[model samples]
Structures are given as C-alpha cells and as structure tokens.
Target: MILVTGATGHLGRAVLDTLLQHTAAHQLAALVRDPAKATDLQARGVSLRVGSYTDPASLAAAMPGIDTVLLISGGGDDDGLQQHQNVIDAARQAGVRRVAYTSRALQDPGTLANELMVRHFQTEDYLKASGLGYILFRNILYMDTLPLFTGPTVLETGINLPGGEGQVSYALRSEMGEAIANVLLQDFTDSRIYHFTGAAAYSFHDVAAALALASGRPVVYHDVAPEVLAARMRERGVPEVAIGRTIGFMTDIKHGQESLVSSDLAAALGRQPTGLLEGIKQLYQL
Candidate 1:
C-alpha cells in the first residue's frame, strides 16, 4: 500500500483526494499526528496510522506494510530537517521500499539566504545517501502565496516585494498535488527527480500586470530593498524570524535562483498548467 504522511496538511490532503479518484482507499494509509484530524480520510476507509515526525517509534509503526511512502517535508520551522531525519530512519528500519520527498526548486540549493530551502537541500542529501529508491519533487513557489504578498485588498495595496526583476515559475498547489499523485500512480521504480514548476516563468512586474488585468484596477509592483521589505513585514506584525526567512527567499530570487521554468509539470499533469492571469483571478476571486 502507499502511505502518505502529513495527511491532514493542504498538499497531503490534496494528494490523498486525487489518489482516491485513481486508486481505492484500501490500497492507501494515512499517517497523521492527530487521528481526529483525519476523520474524513478514515471515513473513506483508509487506514489511519498515528505518527509524529519527532517520534521515531510512531513513524516505524506507521511504515510497516507500506510499499511506497511520501515523506512530505515537515513544518516551516527550523526543526523540520531533524523531523525529516527521524522519518527517514524509521522508514528504512520499517523496510519501506520506495520513498518520495518534496524539495524546493532552486538554481543553487546551497544558497544560505532561505533557511527553509536550505533544510530541503539537507534533507535531499540525507535521502540520497539512505540507499533507498527515491523520487525528488523540486517544487517552485506556490502561486497561491502571491495573494499573501499582496495586502488583504490586492487592488488597493498592489504587490510589494524585494524581488526586483527576478522571475519565478509559480505553480498552483492543487496542480502540484495532482502531479505528485500522478507520479505515485505510475510504475515509477528507479530514483528520479522532477522539477514541479510552472510551464512559464513570470517576473513580479508580469504578476502585477496580471493582477491589474484580473482586478480591473491599477495594481503596481513595488520593488524595494531587502531591509525595506523586512521593515514592512515587521510593521504588519510578522515575527522577526519569519520576516528574515521571507527576506532570504527574496534574496534568493534576486540572485536569479528561482527563474527556471520546466515542462515536467505539464507532462505530469498531461495538460497545460494554469497561467499567471487566470491563477490570479482564481486566487483573488476577481
């Protein structure tokens, strides 16, 4: 059976939902820290295995009898790499055959700016050295997060960032989930890596133009220095560490680490992925 960890999370839930359409619930198991959060999945007849990434014993219990395991990266906090290490060790001990991981899309994984991406890089290295067959999903920034960079009222505050002229191959989280499910449903046995990014790359200016067109309002793109962006985030009550991390991502983009576009996502979905303007409309309800 295929076991999906983080079954209650946004991406994990989407993957399970897509899997239900392609495979029976009997062939699947969901590992979640809180079984109560997985009631909907359990109702669909999927086996619920209580597990925590911090608890190796629980992860070991969850991995037995599973042929394929999707180890969704842990929370955005600093402890995520440690949690992933625990999961990896347990999966190996439990005799899981195939493992898949979600990693970030970056031109240089060694960049020190974004701690989140750094941890993903570290986890990828760990997974590679584990002697197990693995698949790496190098996912780009989510288009859904575009709405977050813009203020509550997108049209009013427009989009502000430290990204300058940098471009991002932003893909929708839903389509990414679909692509991952498609990968797992196939006869994928060998270790392979796929860049799960949008079919096209768009600059912040292009995103602003798309938003303006979608909202029928002039939404300008404001490019500021990293420190200015950090100050803005701080003024909005974002935590210091989070603000630093956000700035780090922008720094990575500014250094041209996020501009790569790939056809792998389209091939995985068997169709064209959503474009910037349409995705903006869907996200903003415009």
Candidate 2:
C-alpha cells in the first residue's frame, strides 16, 4: 500500500491523479489534515486518514498497513524540521518499508542559506539517520512562480529583483508531481537521490528575453539592491517577513545556489522536460 501526505495540495493532487493511472485507488491512502477537503478522494475509493505533522499521534494513526510513504515537505507556522521528524518517527514505529521525500535542489549544506533551506537540510539529515530506505527528490524552483517575480504588467515593467546574472533550472510543479508518481510506482531496494530540474537554466535577463519573444514587446531585466527592493516592498505594504523571504530567495539565486540542470526528471518521465521559453509563454497565457 502507498500513502501520500499533503494529498490535497496542488502537487499532491497532481501526484495522486498520476499515481491512479498506474495503480488502483483501493491500494492508495491519503494523509490529510482536513477530512472535509478530501471528499473527492474518498469518493474515488482512496483511504482518507486524518493527520498533521504537528501531531505525532495523528501521524501514527495514519500509517498502519502502509508499506511505502510519500512525505511531502511543508512549512508555514510550524517548525519544518520537527514536522518532518514527526513523520519519520511515526513511519519508523509503523514499520514502513520505504519513504519518498520531496526536497529542494541546489542547496549547499556547508554554507549559511535561507531559513527555509536550513530547515530542509536539517530534515534531510534526520531522514538519513532514520535507517529507512528513502528516495530523495530534490526539486528545483517552480516555473509557475516566474510570473510572481515579474510584476502584473510584466511585459511593460519587465523583471525587477535583487538577483544579477543568476540562472535557475525551474521545473513545472505538475510535471514534477508526475515524476514523483513515476518514482513511487517503481521498485527500488537501495536509497537514492534524484535532481528533478529543468533541462536548461535561465537568468532573469533570459526570462525577460523569453517574455519579450512571447508577448512581442520589449522587456528588460533590472537588478536592484536588496535593501532598495525591501524598502520598495515595505512602501507597497508587503509584510516584513514576506519581504525578508523574497530577499533571501533572490540572494540565494544571485549567489548561484539554484543554478543546476539535470536529466533525472526527463529520464523518470521517459520524455524531454518542458523548455524554459514554452513554460514562460504558458505562464503569460501567450
């Protein structure tokens, strides 16, 4: 039996939908915090179990009769390291044979990074010590977030951020979900790590060029100082924490922390991953 946590989320739902193509719904289980939101899954014969990473008993309650678990990492209000540890410990007590984790790509453990990444590295270390067979899917930044970095009138405003000449191998969230499902469907005895990323890396300037081509309008990439960007965001009423996170992400990109390309995603899906220009064009609805 296979159990997937965060089964109602965007990537989680996409993964469940893809997993259904390869296996029966009766063989699947979902760990959801809110049972009300998972009615559709229940109607489809998916076993719905109530659980929260903050609640260890709930996690243990959800793990029975499950052989493999797909643990989708999460962070918001709760300490991510503790939350993942809760799941790992519960899985251990439940005697789950294997665990598949969704992790971020291009993070250096030695260097001081973002708070989000620090928590991820901590979770990875804990999972490594758990003594369970695991598959680490180190996913890249999502391509859907490109439009968020670009303003509403991106065609006119172009791309403005603190990053300079940094490249990111952004992959589509849905595509990555399919890749995860493919991995879950396969059989493996040894623990492994896969870098699920785009086929090519693109800098913000390259993104602006892609936007220009897609929209048939002149677009430019402007590199701004972190303090200046934060000040502008503050003036625009962005929360201090949100501003800090944005700056941290841009700083990481500027330092070449997310510039990585891998064929693992394509190999998993048995097809070429989506191209940068195509993904950008779709984001713009062009």
lDDT of 1 at 75: 75
Give the per-residue lDDT of model 2 (tens digit) for 1-286: 9999999999999899999888999999999999999999999999999999999999999999999999999865547788999999999999999888998897574563466677776777888899998889999989988887776887877778988888999999999999999989988799999999999888999998988998899999999898988898899899988888888889889888888889999999899988889998788898
TM-score between model 2 and native:
0.97
The sequence of per-residue lDDT tens digits that candidate 1 reaches over residues 108-220 is 87665776678888899999999888999999999988877766865887777898888999999999999999999998679999999998889889998998888788988
Off by over 4 Å in 2: none
Candidate lDDT scores, in order, read 0.88, 0.89
Q: Report how far residue 165 has shifted in candidate 2, in Å.
A: 0.6
After aligning candidate 1 to the native by TM-score, how far in Å is the CA of 183 from where it should be? 0.5
TM-score of each candidate structure, all chains considered together = 0.97, 0.97
| Clash pairs, model 1 backbone | none
lDDT of 2 at 61: 93
Q: lDDT for model 2, please.
A: 0.89
